[model samples]
Target chain A: MVEHMGAQFLLSMTTGIFIGGAAGYLGSLMLSKRMALVAGPLGHLTLPGIALALLYGFNVSLGAFPFVILGIILIWLFEIRTKLPMEALTAIVFSSGVAVAFLFLPIEQAETALVGDISRVNLWEAFVSVIVTSIVFLVLKKMYSGMVLISISEDLAKSEGMDVRKYNLIYLVLIAIIVALGVKMVGGLLTAALVAIPAAAARNISTKLAHYSFGATIIGAMSSFIGILFAEISKFSAGPLIILTNTGIFLISLVFKNRGRR
Target chain B: MTNDFVLKVKNLTVRIDSQNIIENLSFQVKSGDVITILGPNGAGKTVLFRTLLGLLPHEGEIEWKSGIKLGYVPQRLPFIKDIPLSVNDFFKLKKSSERETKEILDSVGFRENLKKKKIGDLSSGQFQRILIAWALIRNPHVLLFDEPTTGIDISGEETVYSLLARLKQERNLTMLLITHDLSVVYKFSTDVICLNKHLVCYGPPRKVLTMESLRQLFGEEVKFYQHRHG
Candidate 1:
């Protein structure tokens, strides 16, 4: 039964499943850590990665890596050198990335930046995104306690002998890879939703944050699979169609959450 | 002839932004000494505790006699909006074994049924007991508590002190207790330090809480409490 989908869709599904799963897992951890909102700007911030790669003759993901590394370093340095929190650092670095991308990328690529084409996405791109995202998430899952502790109290996290700054820096670099891959698949505009919506929707209902993450993966995959179907049927752009499905789910979750309170 | 010092703070200075929280502070807590630091709010009692644990960044040396592990109980807050952690899970963070966790919780008079309850469901006093259990699990050489009895019941309060007193004697643990409660001040502590921004007095409780010093420290409030207690 599993083999019937053939290697193409099967591999694409593997790419989609794990990438969606990994994003959902890390996204939920970030949500519980209260860094869910940071994903938004960080996603947008990767635009320069694509643009710079085009200009400098490098892979978009590789180009994005340095910028994301810079962003993470800047946040840690700012916290150590100054005292700004991670959220504030994300905003600052994100804006800087957008500015640099705007300044450098040709105006012709602006439309490309706005609409990510998952349909045209090739095997190599999917393979790289899936592999990198999986490895990063695998590492992060092991350090779950350390990450959660940092979210609870930075001082306590440090006293526990886990460098909170280092953990955050690691999270940022992975986030950059995800954002870089997201630019081609979902486009920069909706990439943050790809990280945030699944997690947020799960959080509205689950008791444990871990459970919420699992739920997020299911939700993300379903959104992508169904959105892909709807886009194929309606002949709409896959990126926008996928995001709209996610948004619809988000709104429904919001209503259900409010009703649960009453 | 002496246990010397289990914990020592030498000329500790902490400046957050421009304001000084711990200003040129120096103190020593010997082995088995239960020291209570009395201070009003904003007097930096919490700051002092945080500094000792190497939590908050500070200047100057916090030299500890080797093998001096610390157990801390932070100020409690209402249940976090949503994050799942059972009491057992919380205690495990302190490196306590299941058997030790059960014994410590029982020592603090928590019901056996509550070992599985989520931290969010426990009441204030029950939660504080759980915190105490966490601290005890570390079997720390020094126990630093900031207002440990704030939300406890009267019996729980008595139990806490008796348990602390017992732990100090049995384990020879040194304790640094920061609290505003005067009733237990003389009863539980061997040394009392009157702190208001700086160390105003440090000696045996009777000498430190003299009427003259009371009037000097808190003005009229001390007189009122003294009269009420007397």
Candidate 2:
């Protein structure tokens, strides 16, 4: 029994690290853009999809993906066609998603959708997780500077020859991708914490841009590794433990925060 | 079609919803000209700049000679004021080498020690310097500035204008700037475009904007609007 559990956790830990690291790296930019809270609504928007996955007994992330993609497209379109900001558009779209979710949510298996279960993955699932996480990270790394410039000044970014709207569409799509993959490691409810806490912690202690971005990845990976290990040792849920471990890192980061900063 | 003509605008109109922000606006720019755009607040000064940069959907032509690089210093960014972005990181985003970034910052009169300071922490004068530095990093044939010295101290404001003049002399860079101060128009501008949604006046600064015109402009709502916007 112990041997079986160890094998299962090896795959869990492997997949969890990449997802957490990718989420953390993306979160670094989102935090800088002041759109970190947006993931909570985006996550909530995945509930209808998660409910569909639960009812059909399919993989949960698969169910969550379509809803999130749709919601991001709506937010992206609304942002372009109207003058409303991303936060307002996201709230308007996702609250409706959450409402639609409860209309059909299966009461019996809702726990799996609400608080994620990482231990149940097979080898194929682990491989897919690793590959998707890798692609997401590379794409993000390529456009990181362009996105940063946009955050500082959109007109400046445009004058520098960046297609601001194209970059923004890519940004929204990447968030949808990560949120979908993240739903497996931490459920829809906790996805925001998964993305935000590590990046917030990195912000406190880092004085440079590169340091803040890369450090968030390391912290995210470390949190997932420890949380999964502890979850195995005791019988608590992985979502809360991972988020708790990340929260601990955030608290400790306060002590070492550059004293000159607020 | 002349190579000397850097920009040609033919009846540009920008409409959002039902209202026309800028209507039937036409102008031209020549190479190496320091054109000042003077207007009361909400006279579509910013909208004109955006239209020139091709950042807005508009009706009519905004023609820039092909392959002319453009740099812009916008009026304000209320969002970035609280974001914790350090000076070095901001330059790094422009892909400047460490030495290159240092040299540019020094040229703009920003000290080396302040490199570690978050841009949010900088005073308005310092932040204005940083914006100017960022715009200059990549050499551009044309620059569009919206109230470039609005927040700087009066003494610092003169220095900023002098630096722009120096760049204009050295590089022959074409500059178009919007200013609230009438004195700026008289002191530095080669040509002036006085705008109140449409072209109010257009000619050499001293030629078209004389004391009589200045008094007329200041006598009306333009005076009230300038103070409130400033």
Candidate 3:
């Protein structure tokens, strides 16, 4: 299989797994907190960054980083100031990002920018993905219980002496990082699906948090690997294919959910 | 300063968006006392509770005896029904052992088999009991209940109150409870605090829950229900 696939395809597959697993794990937390819908807007918010990066001839992830961080900060601040739900704040930020993106990006680069073309991934991008993914996993592992407790009830977590605001900020930063890294491979439009779908599927079948997280990671990695392979064979874009694979998994998990209910 | 005092709040005020939700509230909680807070809707009952727990920002002195362990049961768990969280998993948030979880559940009258059942599937009474069990597992010195029996039936409410009373006696735990029902106040509270933004009155249920105070707190629309004294 290694001999058959080109080097770029192999690198893309590896990058996809790392990004997908991290996204899936983070997605589980977001889903548990009912902030899953926020992922889509955050993903879309990466567009201006990618556009700026394209215009400036810099790394797409680097360009997306500031905007993603800005988006997180704005969302957090607006949530505190306006007391609006995260979904609403995300909508406001995402629309602004889209409007800004259209100003800088050439129309020709829009397709690849909207839906990522992972064949352009280099060795540096692959290495960065691995490093960032490892950091995300470690932080998530340490914060998992505390985050879950906060999700259950902020007052309960506070009673236990956990700093809920600090953890929430950390969580948003993690999401910002993941969205920045993911937009190049999954595209801004479909990146949130990479985060959300696996977790959605995992929760349908999992009875415990550990199982849900592990199931999400497995499904995500598998989808990325298989989706990349299928795209290579079918001459289709890998980003949309990966999302389609995750959607399929989500649909299948609903069966397990319904069965368990009965 | 008494050795029996578990919590002390003096001139506590909580303001949000320049509006005071709780103003100049002062109260003391003694060990082994079930302090029931009574108020009408939007009377800042929940705000006061949150302030006492240090969940909300407030001014003035709010002190807990150093190193005192506290357990809390909110009026409702804010979980969506679609999530696949089981009762066992809910307990796992506290990192409780299986035996401990089982013991707590049994103590709260929840069957061990229900551990594997989804938390969303539990009835209102069962969920309330589970919340109680969640608190019990902590071995807290002070337990707080914010309308614990809100959605439960009348008989179920009685059962919950009885359970709370038995637990209070057995554990010698200090309790702070928020309730709308005067019957619960009459039956379970050792002290009652009538609140509408500020403290209306505070003392033993017999002295503080008189018609005038009730009228003052809830206004002319309030209806008083009499129950045989517990």
Top lDDT model: 3
If you score just chain A, what TM-score does every candidate get? 0.80, 0.92, 0.95
How much is the TM-score of the A chain of model 3?
0.95
Error of 2 at B204 (Å): 2.1
Off by over 4 Å in 3: A1-5, A84-91, B80-82, B148-150, B224-230
Q: What docking class should model 3 receive?
A: medium
Error of model 3, residue B89, in angstroms? 1.8
Error of 3 at A72 (Å): 0.7
Residue-wise C-alpha lDDT for candidate 1, range B24-127, written one tens digit per residue: 87777788788998877777888888888777788888988996688776665432334455676566555568888888888777766787776666776677
Cα TM-score of candidate 3:
0.94
Model 3 error, position A173 (Å): 1.5
The weakest ten consecutive residues by lDDT in model 2 chain A span A253-262
Candidate 2 docks at the CAPRI level of medium
| Candidate 1 vs 2: which has more TM-score | 2
What residue runs in model 1 are displaced by over 4 Å at the alpha carbon?
A: A1-12, A52-60, A74-112, A244-262, B56-60, B77-82, B92-100, B112-116, B148-172, B219-230
Worst 10 residues of 3 chain B by lDDT: B221-230
Q: Report DockQ per prediction, comma-separated.
A: 0.36, 0.49, 0.59
User: Considering every candidate listed, which one attains the maximal DockQ?
Assistant: 3
Error of 3 at A17 (Å): 1.3
Colliding pairs, model 2: none
Q: A1-262, model 1: which lDDT tens digit per residue?
A: 4454344444544555566667766777677666666656666667787787667755555665665566555655786798877677767766776787899888876655655555544578678877787787788777776766666566555655677778877777667666666666566567778878888887676645456657787777777776666655686766677677777888888887788669
Error of 1 at B229 (Å): 4.3
